[model samples]
Every structure is written in structure tokens, then in C-alpha cells.
Target chain A: MSEASTPTPQEDERIKETSALRQALIRPELGGIVGTIAVFTFFLLTAFNSGMFNAAGVLNWSTVSAQFMIIAVGACLLMIAGEFDLSVGSMIGFSGMSIALLSVTFSWPVWLAIIVTFAVCIAIGALNGFIVVRTGLPSFIVTLAFLFILRGFTIYLPQTLERKTIIGGVSDVAQGDWLAGLFGGKILGGLFTWMGNAGLIGVFERGTRAGDPVVDGIPMLIVWAIVLVIFGHVLLTKTKFGNWIFAAGGDAQAARYAGVPVNRVKILMFMFTAFCATVFATCQVMEFGSAGADRGLLKEFEAIIAVVIGGALLTGGYGSVLGAALGALIFGVVQQGLFFAGVESSLFRVFLGVILLFAVILNTYIRRLITGER
Target chain B: MTARSTHAPIIQMKDIQKHFGSVIALAGVSVDIFPGECHCLLGDNGAGKSTFIKTMSGVHKPTHGEIIFEGQPMNFEDPRDSIAAGIATVYQDLAMIPLMSVSRNFFMGNEPTKTVAGFPFYDKEYAARVTMEEMSRMGINLRGPDQAVGTLSGGERQTVAIARAVHFGAKVLILDEPTSALGVRQTSNVLATIDKVRKQDIAVVFITHNVRHAMAVGDRFTVLNRGKTLGTAQRGQITPEELQDLMAGGQELATLEGSLGGTV
Candidate 1:
């Protein structure tokens, strides 16, 4: 026993290295990592000469990715809990329209309008959850119903209130509002200005009246996306509630048999999905200073596609938040990479389809290899 | 009948009857499960065995019966209530999430949490350690607690379920046809696990149709035929052949076999 206990240092190191390799191979994010690297490398090879690696290029793609990631992360969680919310796209439009109408038309405080929008969105989210649970209906069908209902309202509400299909001048009301600065606008503006002055970053030709270089600051959307991803990763991997989400999604009957409150977990997932949609809507409305009924059209499918590429099973009970974030990054790179490479923007959909298919196949194959399933 | 124990049973059922609509699943069945003993319920298909166990496990309420648990009359509202009352049922399917890790499946709804900075998180390390220790105690050495339950062998999974129930402080472990789908080696492993659980002073209600299996580990046997108790006997009082005969409706089987032999 004493002789066996005193293993050689080389042997110990060998065992540790092999186990670490095995652990890496079995990780859920392995597919996402591969997909991200493959897509990034493809873009780097094809669009390098077109300024695709420049700061402006990075900002453009990152902004788009941040928007997708916000909802994708929520969709990832909800999917992990064994449900879907198709109305998330419409919820985004509806939330943005509500915030705009409340703050602009009613002359309410911007902060209060945001709060009211969140409350309304959350309530609708809860209703979706409640109906799905009580009626034992598939969330896909229920949320599909909400998808049309919300889209209809988003379009009809503005036309009814102001005889316009779009709500404009949202940024006008948001001006001078401290809360608006928190949710919208650029962060680290001073640092970017300094960088431009020091010739570290490229300055825009259109300078301000004060003659300061117009180097763009990091968008709050990107900040929120990063924060949400980290928060989601921690919640799913470190908390008891995370375990419940997995169990609920894996098998509701089995989870219930083990004493998990499956109903509550699913309901909260629905509410969280809605909350994420509202956050996306608020950021977009504040940034663009306008809201239209078609602002976030087809975003639900995009988010779901992002989640699928992230290695989450559509049937539920298995996923990774970091993987979803990486999936969003891949989307951003491809969509903008195509533009930089002079590929037709209409071909973006084709790229999205091919990437999604490849990701799903790779993910399934990897999972089978890990589980040793035939 | 061999001498019945004078000590009170952990769970006592009197005139238990269950009906699903017009179908009489179980009619007036009574049984007593004592701690530290392996009581085998032997029956054929449609013998009301599933309904009886479901009633005991709180999946179904008895239409006409009284359940006395730990010297107090009780009616469990659901499986959760019975589980809270220390009666754990490991069904044939085992009620385990296949995709989840062993430790996660072991804790499931009753996870051990550690609060840090006013936020509670799953104590994953603790769960893994306890799961490893408990599974090894049941003679099933797991590769790792993080291994998914679906990856485990059928016998190993059953042992894990039994160990999980014991870890959660189950006084009465009702196994519903646990060995029906297992091979010979797996069945023996499960029987060994039952013996281990019995030694730990937990009352084991082993439901099976296999007479040889019952004779191997059972301290007492109760035969159910067509929703009624055929009889109860101590292990020594009845041989395996006699138990098999009784399970097949002794007199009726004998007469039919004799007639067939005569015609041949």
C-alpha cells in the first residue's frame, strides 16, 4: 500500500494530463468553441484586407452580436428548462413601442416609462408561463399565439395613438435623463476620445463642433451582453436553481418525483425570457431614437438558431450559456464578414442556415461520442 | 405461518382498496412492513401489485382503507408527502433524469446547498462525495459522481437509486419490480443491495414475480392474486416450489396440469 501510494511524479503528471484532456473533450461548449474558431478563421482569411479586423469592423459586428446574445442567453436558459418563447421578437417591438409612447406621448419620466414597460412585459411573460403550465400545452404553440398577438398590437397601437406606424423622437425625450445614460448611449467615451487623439484609434472624418475626434465609444448593449452571459453561466453552473432547471427540462415527471417545483421553474424561465426581450428592446429604442412595429422582426428565430448552434438540445435538459454567447459571436462575425467581403447581404441567410446545420450535426456527434452512444 | 414479529410495523395497511373509475385495481388488501426485514410481494401481471405499492407510496389514495405510519394514521396527498414522511418509492423506471450527473440525480429536488453572501448554491463537491460514499456502500463503485446516470449499467442505476433513498433517510424503501428488466447477474446485485438496505434497519418492500429471487433474499413473503392477498408466510415456512405453486394459483394449476398429463 505504501509503495502504491508513492507514485512517480511522471506517472502522476501523465494521469492528470489524460484526465484533463478527457474533461475538455466532454465539455458541452466544445462544439461552440470549434464553430467560433472555424467561423472567425474563415472571416479573417476572406475579409482581412477589407478592414474587417479594424476597430470599426469589430464594433459593427460586436454591436449586432450583443443584441442577439441578450435574447439568445435567455432563450438558452428557457430551452434548458424545456420550453420555448417565440413571442420574444414581438415582445421586443412591443416593449420598445410602449417605452416610446409612454415617455414621448404621455410626457412621463423616461425611467418610469422603462419601469412600466418592464412590468408589462414581465406580466405577459408570466401569463405565457401560467397558461402553458395550467393547460399542459406546448410552449411553442402558446408563444406562437403570443407572437402574432404582440406583433399585431405593436403595429396597431402606434397607428391608433398617433396615426403613424412608427414612434419617432424617443431619443429626444431620453436626452438629459441619467437613467437613459445607464441603459443607452456609449460608455468610456472619454477613453476613446483620448485614444483617437493619441493616434491609437482611427478618428472619424465628421468631428464634433469642439474639434474632438469622433471615435466611437463601447456600446452599453455590448456591456449588458457580457454581464448577462457571465450571470447566466454562474446561475446555470453554480446554483441550486440551475440544477432544478436541468432536472425540469430533462424529465418533468422524474423531477417532480424528486420534489422539484417544475411548474415554478418553467414559469420563471418564461418570465426571464420576456425580461430579456424588453432589455433588448429598450436598448435599441434608446440607441436608434425610434420604434417601429418591424424593429425586431424574425429575432426570435435568430435567437433560437443561435441557441441551437451553442449546443443546446431542442428537446431540453442540456445546454451551456457560454456556448450560446459564442454562438452569437459567430453570427455577428459571419453577418458582417459577408458585408466586408462584398458578398450580397441576402446571402447571409444562406450562411446562417449552413452554419446552424453544421453546428447541430457537430454537437450531436460530439454528444454521442461523449455518452458512448451508438 | 412462521412466527410474526411482536414489534409494531413501520407502516400498516388495513383493508386497503383502490379503484380507477369502475376498474377495481386493488380490493381490501392489507400488509405490514417491519423495519430490518425484506418483505417480498409476489404476484403475476394484473394482480393489483402496482396499485398497492402506488397507494403505499402516495401516488394513489386508497378508496377504502387506513394507513398507519410510524404509529400514526396518515393519508399521503402525493408522492412528495410520502417522501417527506420517509417512505421512498423507487419505481421500475427508477424516476431518474438520464441526462443529469449522478450527484445531481441523487439530490434532485432535495439538494444540499451552501449559502455564500446571502445566496444559496448547490454544494456540488459535497453531493459528489456523499454520492460516491453511498453508492460504494451499496457495492456499486461509480466511475465518478459527475458521470451521467444514463451511462451507468442497469444494475448500477438501481443500486444508486436505493442508495439515494437510504441517504435521504428513507425508513421504508418500496421497490416496484426493480429486477423485472435486469439480467441474472443484475438481479443478484439488486438482491444484495436489498440485503444491505435491510441490514441498515430500513424496511424493504420488494415487489417481484420471481419466486427464486424472493426465496433468495426475502425474510417474509406475501402473495397477491387478483387484487387480494392469497396468503403470507415466513421464509422458512414455505419452500420456493410451494411459493411458486401458490403464486400460480396452487389448486387450479394442479388440476389443469393433471388433466393435461392424462390427455397426453
Candidate 2:
């Protein structure tokens, strides 16, 4: 009794204290955190004098990275719940075209168009989840079907109605619109101007807009990324629902036996993935001032890759949102850093394939350590 | 064990019958489970043991007869309803996620939370402390509450499942082949856990095909053949060999031996 209640150092020899290094190695985010540091260091050493760290250049990559971060957040959570959203890339194009058709061509208010677009996309996501659960089919095949269907609609709709694939003049239609501003507007303009006046930031020397800061303000894209990451991180780590996500992904039958509503948790995750895709679409449309049927092609794979690099196992049930966010950051840095370092941009695909393989190997090692599997 | 019969049974399944279309799984099986005693259900693979327990745990509603739980005829539509009524069944697989931490698995669906600034969050410290304390009470020393459950041995995982059921206020605990997959030492550990739980006055329905395991901890033993009960016996009234013979259908075996022209 004494030995059972009190785990003294002399008692229960099997209870060896895990070494700190071993503990760190067991964390799911270890690979992502390490990769983030390694990528940043590599870029710093190779592209230091190439203007990659300057405000303008920093924004350039940050904007690209933020786009990845938004979608990666959704994919990370869905993957943790033991599902995938192959339709996410197509969902983006479909939603963007919906917004453009409603506001620019159909003469609907931009705010109404944005709200309706989100609603439609979210419903489609829920349908994807519903079919997977009710039919007991793998989400891969189900969403794969939606991927082609939505993309086909995206191209077919514009060609049939507007006689063109790309719809422009959306920015003009969205001017002074409340919902559009949330996606397309910038913030902290006054602070950037003050910094420019104080010589803290570079100013245009002899352009038409001389004496203004080269980088005016932080775009809403970056802000949205930060907000979504914090939200996803908190939702995953600090809530009862978060625990359910892990359990559902780890073992769905076991989770159901434990009284968790596994079906509902999975469906909600699919909807969230669609919602993230829509956010990306809205931001892209507002930034480009146009929507093309070909927009967001293959972005689903990029989001999944970022999530995998963030240390999430492809098998699900284990991951970290902060890790996925850092993974997106690495992608943004490396993609733009190659251009700054005078490397062929096509080699970026090669880097992705190599990094994914490395991350998977590291994740498998971690899984074996956790499960003691051979 | 004699002292436990003085009070009424916590659960009484009277003439429960379950059928799957034309095939009858359980036909009029009755059992009484009392508090503070281990009731062992011994059966072969096709003896309808799984069907009987599923009916008791509300997985399948009995087609005939009724379940009188706590002296009232009750109906359970689903497993969740049975859980709400203080009946918890830990299956052979243990219903545990191998990758989740012990504390997280401990409170998988029913989590305790504390409100912080109008937002509720999972109370980790409370959960961890309770998990460690409850696990120690079962004589299984965990490294820590944060250790993944997959790292534990099979017996330890079974104990964790039992400990979780007890912590959540289970009045009747049903274990489905708790030691079927463990080594000899691990099997003894799970039997000891059953003993500990029975001491706490919780009715433990231990299901097993092993006669030696059942005799070690069972206060009352009920053997099932096909879909019918072969009567029940107290600890000292039945020998292990008789129990084993009853499980394997001794008459049928003897008839087969005779038909094959035994060497004797």
C-alpha cells in the first residue's frame, strides 16, 4: 500500500524520469520548430544583402506566407480530426467566382455577395463531411470528387454567363464596402508614415509619390493570418472540443465508445476548412481586383504540405497549430528567398518534395517512440 | 461473499431475449448482480456472452423481457443512456486512444472545466492530479499523468479503463475479457484490480473464457451454454474442473470420444 500510494525513488524502478532531451524530442512540434529556425538561418546567410529583410521585401514574402498560413490552419485541424479536404483548392476558386459574379456582374451589393459566398462554401463543406460520415466512405475519394466538380463549375459558370473566364472591376465595385474592406484594407498607415518621416523606414526618393514610405502599412492578409492562427491554436489546445478532435482522429470507434460525438466533430472540421478556403479566396479577389477560374489551382496540396511539415502526422490525432503556422512561414521565406538569392524558382517544387519526405520520416520516428511500435 | 446477499441486487436482468432477424442470440437469460461482489460470466465463443452483456449495457435492447435496474423497469435506447444510468462497460479493446495522454483519455467525453474571464477552459492541473491519484489507488504506478496510454502495458491500460469508470461514478462495472490479451503477470494485475473495485462496493461483471481467472476473483459464477444459463454457483460450491467441463460441454465431448472409438 505504501509503495503504491507513494512513488518514492526507491520504489517502482520502472518509473525512470524521462530525460529533458527525450521529452523535447517527443513533442509533435519539434520538427516544425527546428525547421523554422533552420530555414530562417539558411536564408539569412544566403540572402542577407539581397533586400530580403527590408520592409518592402519582408511584406512581399509575408503576404504570400500569410495566405498559406490561413489555409494551413484549417487543414491542420481537419487532419488532426483524421480527415482531409481535397476540395479546399477548388472551394477557393468557386467562392471567388461567386463573389465576383454577384458583385461585379450581377450588380449585387459587395457585402451581400461576400456573405452569400461564405454561406454557400460552408454548406458545401458540411455536405462533404456529411457524405463521408453517412456513407462511411473515405474523405479522400469524396472530396476528390468535389474538387473536380467545383473547379468545373468555376470555369463553366463564367464562360457561359459572362463570356469570359476572368472577371475584373471587382475592386471598383467593392470600394467603400464594409465587408470588402475587412478583407482588402490595410492598417497602421499612420505608424508607417511616422517611421518614414523619422528615417526608420525607407522612403521613395524620386518617384511620383516621393518622401512616402516604400511599405505603407500591414495588409489585412497578414492580420487575418495572425488572428486565425491564434484562434485555431487556442481552440485546439485549451478546449474540451480540442481533446475530442485528438480522440476522434486517434481512434474514431474508441472515441464514439467514450461518448464523444465523433460525427459532429468531423463535420464541423470540414466546414471550418471550407471557411478558411473562402477567407483565402476573398482576400485574393480583393487584392487582385479580379477573379479567374484558374485561381487557387493546387493550393490544397500546398496547405496539406505545410500542415505535414508542421509536424502533424498524415495519420492524424497528433499535431500543433503553432507548428503548422511556423511551417507556412518557412514556405513563404524559402519561396521568396530563392528569388532573392538568384536561384531558379522552379526548384521550389523540389524543395517541397524533399522537405515533405524529411518531415514524414521524422514524424514516423516520433510515432514509434510514442507507441513503442517496431 | 455471504454478507453481500443480504441486500437487494443493484441490477436484475429478467428473462432477457435478443434476436437478430431470424437468428436468436440470447433466449431468456437471467442474472442478478449485487454490490461489493464479482459476478463472473463464463462462456465459449458462440455462447451468446457478448449478446447478453450488450443487452445489459444497452448496446442492444432485449426483444423480450425487461431490465429492472435499481428495482425499476428501465429502457435504454443507446449506450449513452446506459452510461448515464451508472452502467459502464469496458470492452476487450478498452475504448482508449493509444496516442492521447492518460489524463486526456481519463476525461475524454466528460471533461471538467474552469471559467477564466468568461471563457471555459479544461482544468489540466485538476485532471492530472486526479488521474495520478486514482491510478495509484489501483496499484498501477504511472510515470506521470501526461504519459501516453500506448506506453503502458496491456494490464495497465485495462486498469486505466476500470479506474476511469469508477471515477465517473459507475455503479455497475462490466468488463469484457479484461485479461484475454495479457501475459500471466499482467493477467494477475487485472484480477487484482477487479478485487480492488469490488471492495469499493461496485458491482463488477467480469466476463472471461478462462476458468482459473474467474475462480480467483468471482464471488458468484454463471456459465452460459449457447443462449441459456447452466445455473450459477457460489465460490466453494463448484470445483474448477466442473466449471471447465460445463464450459466445454462435457457430455458432447464424451459422446464424440466414444463415436471416434477411443484408444481405451
Best by DockQ: 2
lDDT over C-alpha atoms for residue B55 of model 1? 91
lDDT tens readout by residue for model 1, A1-374: 88755323122222233377666767678777988989888888888999888778889999999999999999999999999999999999999999999998889999999999999999999999999999999999999999999999999999999999788898888998887886798888899888888888777666363435444689889999999999899899899899999999999988887889999999999999999999999999989898898988999999999998888988899889999998898888888889999999999999889988887887777566545477
Tell me the RMSD of model 2 versus the true structure: 2.6
- Clashes in predicted model 1: 0
On lDDT, the candidate that comes out on top is 2
Taking all chains together, the TM-score of candidate 1 against the true structure is 0.93
Q: What is the TM-score of chain B alone in each candidate?
A: 0.93, 0.95
Model 2 CAPRI quality = medium
Q: Candidate 1 lDDT, tens digit per residue, B226-249?
A: 899987899789887677677777
Relative to the real complex, the DockQ score for model 2 comes to 0.58
Per-residue lDDT for B215 in model 2?
A: 95
Local error of candidate 1 at residue A119 (angstroms): 1.6
Worst 10 residues of 2 chain B by lDDT: B255-264
Candidate 2 Cα misplacement greater than 4 A, ranges:
A1-17, B253-264
